[model samples]
Target: MGGEHSPHVPERVPSDDDPADDLPDGLLVADRDGRVVVFNSAARRMTGIAASAALGRDFRDVLPLHDAEGRDWWKCLSPYEGLTIRTRHPERSLFLADGHELLVTAGYRRDAEGRVERFSVCLRDAAHRARQERDRADLVSTVAHELRSPLTSVKGFTATLLAKWTRFNDDQKRVMLETVNADADRVTRLITELLDVSRIEAGRLEMHRQVVDLAGEARKVIAGRVAAGDPEDRFRFEARGELPEMWLDPDKVDQILGNLVENAVRHGAGTVTIVVEPDAHKEGAAVTVRDEGEGIPPEAAQRVFRQFWRGPGGNRRGGTGLGLYIVKGLVEAHGGAITVRRGPEGGAEFRFTVPAGAPDYAS
Candidate 1:
């Protein structure tokens, strides 16, 4: 007789203290009569509706689910009442009364007699996830676009040289070959940055520590840049005091300096200044790289060290946008800290510190 009778619905709606309220995902339940029974905390947060306001109310009256074109979606739920279909619809855009959008996955719960007992909908803020997905896509597109330019140039130049070998004079051939070589170097740099990103993500970026002269390394970076045809007058190096040797990965230091200097040279105007001194407080050495270019905006400064962040105007000067991220990671890896601020010379100043003394070789 018990099995023959229909399932009984509770007289009172489920309270906020219901077991379903503990779920991380937003849970909304409506009984067979379409009255809201379970409006959990997550659901309240997602819809901006208090449990007190939603409980015991008709589901259709309490929740306004609208489509993109502002059409009511209440009719979509009617078919599930008698149907035995239990389904999950992911990323379903549901517009709330206050015009906020929620991405929800909804399901139906049925009784043994093949009747819908209740419906459960899980929800989250769609705008945030949508923005994240868009950013990821933009990063992928930017990297692909950056890589294609150099590859196109290299391929075209090499093909022309190989096909028309004897037709060109020595000087002409040399110029074309040099252009190809430069493009190849560009490709190599991009690939190296990509590899560095992968290594960083996998936590496999191992550092080979040794005693390195801080001031000496900074000089070498400036000299190398100038020797490679960077303007000699554009750079200035100053040692505030006698700098001490640091125990760190020398190559990583070179990379950190090289990236900062290159960013300055590309984005900066006038002269770029590099300063090295002993950090008495941290018992370490401090290095500052400042440029006389248009400094980073106050609002944009915080995002400078994030991966694939290229500021508001985009990468107009052919930057990968990973340099600063890599620099920050390398600084932290060396048990140091780095900061960016507006330089006195009206540009961005990056200062970092590395601990003095040799790293433990035993580890």
Candidate 2:
């Protein structure tokens, strides 16, 4: 279930640019008399019968949908003999004679006299919905699983401190308080990641753009690590070629840099190096984060960016396994791409490119 699911071919909404034949979802339209009028290519694919074969024929003869109980759907819902007020049959799984399943929804177009004029049915594969449902379930399970530890720590420490405030010495209290603080931060981060995932999945991630200094953001990341007790000598930064000035979300750039650098410092070894340069192959500039440690395997390079992925040594350290995934989403949201490879110094190297020089729509 962790692996990718079957392709989700979304049905196209009928528009001037999107014709019925071009729809990714199956569709069938019939006259009030049940004569097939429109059978799109998707329907052809699902039924393995050409539009020409189905057109002008009775739709019952074409689709011949049956329920799990072997009851004929056409016989069950005689749209022609139904009440004039009948509008639609909501989407549900219905099978063909050969046992191929299709998600089918039927609508009854009504005339001014409240009689059915056209019977329209939208068809889709069930795999897409099944995958979506599984994803939602996974997210819910992950939230519950990930939040319990930190929440318990925060609650336990806070409760113990409140109850035994006078019993613990200053040093002991400080440690407990620090532990609570760290757990609180972890909870906050988990919540933020959940929100980000929600927004990313819903395609509602907002981009507020301004003139950003990409290289400068990298410097800030390095400086932040140094200030947080990391040795300055353990880090290196380089800028190559021309750096372009363009509109971008500076905070998102900072986030991407921070996550990659943090991952390097925590999971990788030796000195971490960051480079910024013009991407000759892409319109945007490029940034690379490399570490002088054992590099990732060739096979895992692609899987590193997916959800719930962790490095070989990941369990020893703590992470939600979402940072790289979020970083990928953020970079792609900026019209950018990210990839990982073996570093020249024998460690993991992550490089990403964002489309530069395009004016943000808000501008």
Candidate 3:
């Protein structure tokens, strides 16, 4: 099927004024006769075929693409024989003879009678799409791994309790039931995290505005840690200035503080400190959480808030790494910003500020 192209094929070197060369993706245009008449610089670069060699050549000969099943894509397309009303082929993954993959889309330019006058093919790198697939795979792996432990405990305990109901004393039975309850709560929390991640990513995170006491929220978080078996003496709360009531989402504030304080305990060490004060720049509030442990490395400060980030104690400490990312999203949704730095005690310090909602602010 390969043959010499038309000698009459027009050719011109692409220059700054050439709009086709400015395209981010490769573009190739061919006439009705099927010879490449417009091969932009991007096309030449993507295909590694010089303009001089491609301009006068058959479009299929210039770039031989095949489908995953090894079918010749150009023949499958049959651009010249498609339905008269068909003007485009949606983007799909294709491969060159050498096995390099590309994202391709085709368009047909037609005349009044619906006769093909010319056609164009667009080309894009497949890296971005491949990355998305990998990220999805990682999410599946994480969810499965996290669910396995709690679900296994729940199943084992329930089955054992049912099988040996009369063999165990009340105290032993109570312990098993309590363990099952904790595992169930773990599953529920994991599911909630998944939902929160989806909502945050889709920009659907909702907020309910109400008058709130910022310092009081911090105390509630510490009290929760104390109730959860953490030493009451291991945490401290400080208010530097007069606190003012502001309109904010109480649940979101609780969630934010809870995640930060938990992170300090899990990844850091020693006493945890919470500082709340009036926002000097805005009629809002600012809070800082610090711990007396090895802080986040300077090199990793920026990536700490990203999804799936892990610290030095990663595998040793249980976490999905979505905590800080969710914390960031929640804070930003509240018209606030968060940052991390080395604290005065040479430990990790996370500081976040939230703006007071507008007087007329409503959910």
Candidate 4:
């Protein structure tokens, strides 16, 4: 008699036709018209609504839902077919009537002819993913924060000593100043390389290129260094024929020359030479810097330009390991290519070619 009077019997306890009936979370199904056609036991439990009461009502009217941005999820979902939705907005936390939180995903279904006929949305809580992101961000922030003060101190002390070099005895001044300067340079290189890598990854690298004299700039870099071990200064210039003027970025050319010369000075104990030749193998201007010191090991020759990479004995001296990377970036940005090889006499050589076309220096 109670059943006859009530008309409130639940759908026959999830027969094979309603596989979603036993799901742990809510399941919903609505027709294209947006009328509630199927509400599982889990959904009833989530929304605290009896199936009989929700059967024919509009899905939105029965249990309202909003997206992450506080927009009406039902309205957005109504027109689209087979789309999933996720929300992470602060104000619109995904909470059920029973005060439980859930991460929701909803998709639609269409008939064989490709007409959207029904849609279903299901949700599972996503408290874990949110926590992981927070932890990762915290770690990067902490590393950056801890590196600040020590780096600043190193740079500051080095500057102070350099500024007051005349006040100290020659022997004491040389030792202190060199050590301080080296450490400061090391720190500066690390910070700069880190920032550049970040910028490159973010696709924000901007190049300021202009017409430049490659031969003159190459000479300047060569003249600045004193030959450490070689009987004569390693810096040499060989013009195969007549050097051609090419349109390129002056700053980038300087950077390229400086990086190559510095690399030669660091690895080669002897002489480093800069040679300019008209491209015989290809059509372009070719510049080569060869060092007479111990050549790069066969295994390491190819990887010389990789980011944060170090060659044999590269560790004895301090470096950010970014010089070659920057060189490569700047060269490529100028529409040129750079290469490394072993010279005939026995040492490492780097050659790069700039194409004949005028580079848009403002990029």
Q: What is the TM-score of each candidate against the true structure?
A: 0.63, 0.84, 0.71, 0.53
- Per-candidate count of clashing residue pairs (backbone under 3 Å): 0, 0, 0, 3
Q: Choose 1 or 4, whichever is better by lDDT.
A: 1
In model 3, which runs have C-alpha deviations exceeding 4 angstroms?
1-83, 94-125, 242-245, 280-283
* Ranking, TM-score, top scorer first: 2, 3, 1, 4
TM-score between candidate 3 and the true structure:
0.71
Q: How do the residues 1-363 of candidate 4 rate in per-residue lDDT, one tens digit apiece?
A: 001122332232334567778786677776655666788887877667888776655667766766455666556555433333322222324655445566666665766666557656675545555775775686466446535645776776677677886777878767766776666675666677667666765666676655566777877666655433433445677767765557776766887898888888777756678888777765568899888777888888778887656755765764557678878877787678888888876888889988755564444
Which candidate has the top score in TM-score?
A: 2
- After superposition, the stretches of candidate 4 with alpha carbons farther than 4 Å from their true spots are 1-182, 226-232, 359-363
Better of 1 and 2 by TM-score: 2
In the range 1-363, model 2's lDDT, one tens digit per residue, is: 011222332222333443787877888987766677778878888889876677766778878889889999988988777899889989889998889888999999988988888899899877777887897798788878889998999899999989989999999999998998998899999889878877887788899888788888899999999999999999999989886775788888888999999899988999999999988996679999999887899999889998777876875788888899999999999888999999998999999998775664534
In order, candidate lDDTs are 0.81, 0.85, 0.89, 0.67
The local lDDT score (0 to 100) that residue 20 gets in candidate 4 is 75
C-alpha-based local distance difference test score of model 2: 0.85
Candidate number with greatest lDDT? 3
lDDT of 4: 0.67
Model 2 residue 344 distance off true place after TM-score fit, in angstroms: 3.3
Estimate the Cα RMSD of every predicted model relative to the unseen true structure.
7.7, 7.1, 6.9, 15.0
